[model samples]
Target: MQSCELSVIKYILFTFNLVFAISGIGLIVAGALVLSDVGEFDHFMEGRILAPPVVLIVAGCIVFLVASLGCYGAIRESYYMLMAFALCLLIILIIELAVGIAAAVYKNDFQMTMKDLMKSSMQRFENSKGDRTAWNNIQTKLKCCGVEGPTDWPENTRPVTCCHATREGSPPPEAHHCRSAAPQDGILYMDGCFYQLQEKAESASKILIGVGIGIAFVEVIGIILACWLASAIKNKGD
Candidate 1:
């Protein structure tokens, strides 16, 4: 009966390690996707926005390495390796929980800080070419004109990016019509970039928090299995 149970535990640990490896890969992909989605806007938030995804990717790599250790331990029935795997998992679980809490705090802090930073950037829009280009990119991508709305800009001075026609890959016949003066009705985007970006950031923040917490739960299970298997292996040897 002890032999039978030891074999069962070994296989189960091996299978769990396989699943854990796959989850690490999944986390890498998720982090990369999130990074690409929000990378362009990093300057606005001073790169605070990139922290969660970067953390996820780093954690994924670490998990992948630890999963390999786990698989080796399970296959060899090495008591020490299994204990080390459990310890690594416990550390990772703590880090993940901390990251989830940080993400939640950041999400709230972002709402307060974002508007001030955007408005500051807007003040530099006309004087700084970088700001102008950034604003144009945000406006074109989000289909928004200014900070709050088109009226945020001086009358008849909105950039060509504000025009829906230009945003759709169709330049106006007269650049002056799009830039110097407002075009016909429905030609320009009426929304603001701030709210659109905020929504996107909030959504990303939620994803980070959710994923971090979810992965931590998985790690707890892995820790339990690893410890249990390690103890069983030791008992069998004795």
Candidate 2:
């Protein structure tokens, strides 16, 4: 009966490890997607903004490696290996929790940072060709006029990109009018890009927090299973 129970537990552990391994891959993919999305606005962001995705990717790699160890330990009935796996899982759980907490705490500060960066970018828009191109691309793509709104641009100097397209894939009629301090009603985009970009950043941070907390629960279960199996193996030896 003891032997049979041990066999069942071992298989159960193996199955759990398989799921854990796949989750690690999912984490990597999730991180990569977030990173790619944020990369589009890299010109408008600071280095610290990349931390969450990068951390997720690194954590995923570590989890993958640890899960393999768990699988091997379960198959071999190695008490030491199982204990080590539990210890690693504990470490990972702590890390995930820390990241989730930090992300939640820093969210407000992140908004302020983004606002300052956008203002700085706008200030540099004229003298820096790179900034000019980036601003134009963002204005057109986001369908927004400026950091705050159309008036954020210097008087009578709004770019055509700030103007709404007259029809699909066609330029706005009388594009020159966009340069006027005040274009005709509905001729220019009224919203600011800052809020849109802020929303995206916040969404990404939420993803990080969600994933971290969700995966931490899984890791906790794995840790308990590993420790239980390790204890079982020890009892069998006794």
Candidate 3:
């Protein structure tokens, strides 16, 4: 019975390690993609948003290494390797917990930081080609005019991209023509981009925090099983 139990425990640990290894690889790939394209937005965002992807890549590499150690220890029933694997898992769990807590506590501050960044980008929208292009793309995609409203633009002269009739092709009866000399309230987009960007950032942060916590929980389970199996092997040998 003891032998059978040990086999079952080892199998479970092995399967968990394999699954975690695959997950780690997925994270690494995702993070790499983000990091590769991050340069495009660096001018506008100032590389502030790059931290999360970098963190993911680092954590993923660590997770992959720990998973390898766990798998090898389980398969070979190596006591030392199991101990090392458990130690790594504990360290990762603590780090993840700290990250999750920090994210939650600083959630509002992060949003404000992003908001300020976007505001600054908006202030320099016309001066920098990259900023203008970024703002135009954002406005076109989000159907938003400026950081706050159409009035946020200099002299209340909204961009052609903000003209709904120009972009949407179906202007309301009250909508004014974009080429008109006077600024028309009905012509430009009514909504602002700041809140939309903030909401998206917050949602993404929540998902990341949730994933981190879930992974930490799984790591704890893996650590316990690995330590238990190592102890069982030691006692059996004795």
Candidate 1 per-residue C-alpha lDDT over 150-183 given as tens digits, one digit per residue, 9 for 90 to 100 = 7777754567787766455766435456565543
Best by lDDT: 2
Residue pairs in clash, model 2: none
**Alpha-carbon shift of residue 95 in model 2 (angstroms):** 1.1
Which has the better lDDT: candidate 2, or candidate 3? Answer: 2
Model 1, residue 72: displacement in angstroms? 1.0
Better of 1 and 2 by lDDT: 2
Clashes of each: 0, 0, 0
- lDDT of all predictions: 0.81, 0.85, 0.73
lDDT, candidate 2, 87-196, per-residue tens: 99998888877877786788788777877888788888778888889888888778888887888887655677888766789768464688773645677888888877
Number of clashes found in candidate 2: 0
Better of 2 and 3 by TM-score: 2
How high is each candidate's TM-score?
Answer: 0.87, 0.92, 0.82
Q: Please list all clashing residue pairs in model 3, or write none if there are none.
A: none
Cα error of candidate 1 at position 177, Å: 4.6
